[model samples]
Target: MIIIIAGIGRIGYTLAKSLCDKGHDIVLIDSDKEICNKVSAEIDALIIHGDCTKTKTLEEAGIEDADIYIAVTGKEEVNLMSSLLAKSYGVDKTIARISEIEYKDVFERLGVDVVVSPELIAANYIEKLIDRPGILDLTIIGRGEAEILEFIIPEKSKVAYKKIKDLGRPQDYLIIAIYEGSELKIPSGDIELKPGDRVLVLVKKDAVDIIRKMFLE
Candidate 1:
């Protein structure tokens, strides 16, 4: 996928690097010439040194063919306007990072596909960690209908040394993958749970409590 990212600050630069590492085509825009020149040489991406809110600048960054348009400048106005222009040009998806939580609903209503509040997301992650001490990670998927969770099996746990097919409420959850000592393995009925194995599972939203009690508690 070709992704056009406006603003090459910390967030934008990090995102570009990750996507570029994944073999996605990336185009980056920013007003700082030195930063653009530096990143252009270091990262495998097309860098445009211009204001993204301008039509000429966005066109230079190949907005017309961008599969994903992301606006994440520190300033909200620039991010909003650039995303709007990208959407008008029929970009397949548009994402904007907003500092203000109040504008999230309004931005989505105006045709922005996604509005992200970094602060809120971070806070929620911290709260989840505090509430669920054993859950390594949690991602709410399908808009709350399902979830993807990561957990590391503890020694002497009830599920340890058990086969995948013997887990509690297997009908309500799917063991997708397992991470064991730097290796990732696809789960199957014959796979046995072991201590310190990091497991990734997808489950129905309502099954989270049950699974937590079975493995985490």
Candidate 2:
């Protein structure tokens, strides 16, 4: 995947490095030349020093062939405009980061594929951590309609030691993956979930409490 990340701040830099480590082609754009220079030396990605909202910079960053364009600048206006511009340039997907809680709807209405608010996400994450100690990680996706939760299967979990098939089909949630020690395995009908195994579950927001109780309580 060819990904263009606008902004070289903490989030953009981290995203670029992680994506590059995953063997994806990443291009970074930023208005700060010094940050770009510093980031260029640290991350294995193409760095363009320019405004992401500008077509000239987008062209320089090869927006025409970009599979994904992510605008995560500190400025919400820049992020929104850059994403809109990327969409116009034929990028397959556009993700914009906004700090304002109220502009999510407007940004989506303007055609951004994903609108992320760092503050909102952080608050949710912290809330989950306090409310659900069993959860190790929580990623809200599908526009907040669903979440992917990572947790360890407790010894007393109702679903532990049971084959996935026996856990009941046509369920409200899906156990996608299990990590046993150092090995990662995809969930299947006959695979029995063992206690202490790390599990990744994809479930709707409404089903979170139900699954948490079954596994954590």
Candidate 3:
């Protein structure tokens, strides 16, 4: 896939690197020449030193043929304008990172494909980390109707010594995998949950409380 990334800041640079590593064609644009050069040197992608909101710059970056266009500048206005321009130029999909909460509704109303608020995402992540210290990460899918949670087995967990199938797990929730130390293994019915094990589980939104009671609490 060809991805055009606007703003070669920390988030943009990281995203470009990850996509480039996956063998995607990435075009990075930034107003700061130093940042553009620095990131270009680190990754195998085309880097252009120009403002994303400018039509000429975007045209030079081949926005017309872009599969995905992402605007992640710190300024919300710039990100929004750049995304709109990308869409107008025939980019297949446009994603923009916004800082102001009020603009989210506007973005949705404008038919923006995706709008991400780093602050909100970070706050939620931090809150989850604080509330569930054993949880390594959490991803909401099915439009937030379902969640995938990664948790480390605590020594005091009730199910720590029990077999996978004996935990009385609800049908809506499924244990997907278990990581014992450095080894990742699919959890089998006979496999016993042990302390220090990292477990990945998929649960429906309605079953979240059950998951909390069973694993978190």
Candidate 4:
């Protein structure tokens, strides 16, 4: 995929590096010459030194052929404008990083494919950590309406030593994978769950509270 990223700050740099490592073509736009130079030295990606919101700069960054365009500059206006311009330039996807939660509706109405709020996400993550002590990890899917959660089976849990088939196949969630010691396996109906086994479950958002009571309690 050809991805164009505006800004090379901490968030942008980390995301660009990760995507580049996955063998995707990346082009970065930033007004800071030093930051661009620093990133150019560290990664194999094209760096453009110019205002990302400018049409000429975006054209030079090959925006017309870009599969994804992400704006993560410190300034919210710049990010929103860059994303809007990228979409106008026919970029397949446009994503903007916004600091203020209130600006989300306007950005969405302006045709930004996605709006990400780092602060809000961090706050929610912290809240989840405090609320669900037994949850190992949580990944929101389908616009936060569902989740893929990683958890460990406790020794005293009722489900321990029980075959998955006997549970009548949980209607609200699906056990996707299991990690027994060092081995990871896709769970089957007849598989017996053991204490301390790490499991991955895809669950409906509304059913999370009930599932937690059944397994984590």
Task: State which candidate has the highest TM-score.
Answer: 4
Each prediction's TM-score against the native? 0.84, 0.74, 0.88, 0.93
TM match of model 1 to true structure: 0.84
Could you tell me the lDDT of residue 90 within candidate 2? Answer: 86
Model 1: ten consecutive residues of lowest lDDT: 208-217
Estimate every model's Cα lDDT from 0 to 1: 0.90, 0.90, 0.87, 0.90
Candidate 1, RMSD to the unseen true structure: 2.6
Tens digits of per-residue lDDT, candidate 2, 11-110, equal 9988899999999999999999999899889998999999898899999999999999999999999999999999998888999999988999999999
Comparing candidate 2 with candidate 4, which one achieves the higher lDDT? 4
TM-score of predicted model 4? 0.93
lDDT of 1 by residue, 1-217 (tens): 9999998988999999999999999999999999999999889999999999999999999988999999999988888899999999999999999998999988998889999988888887788678777888888786678888899988867889999988778788898999998999999999999989999889888878788667754
Which order, best to worst by lDDT? 4, 2, 1, 3
How far is 126's C-alpha from truth in model 3 (Å)? Answer: 1.3
Error of 4 at 121 (Å): 1.7
Model 4: how far residue 2 lies from native, Å: 2.1
lDDT of 3 by residue, 114-211 (tens): 99998988887688668755667888786788889887878888888999889875588889989999998988899999988889999887886678
Q: Number of the top candidate by lDDT?
A: 4
List the RMSD of every prediction in angstroms.
2.6, 3.6, 2.1, 1.6
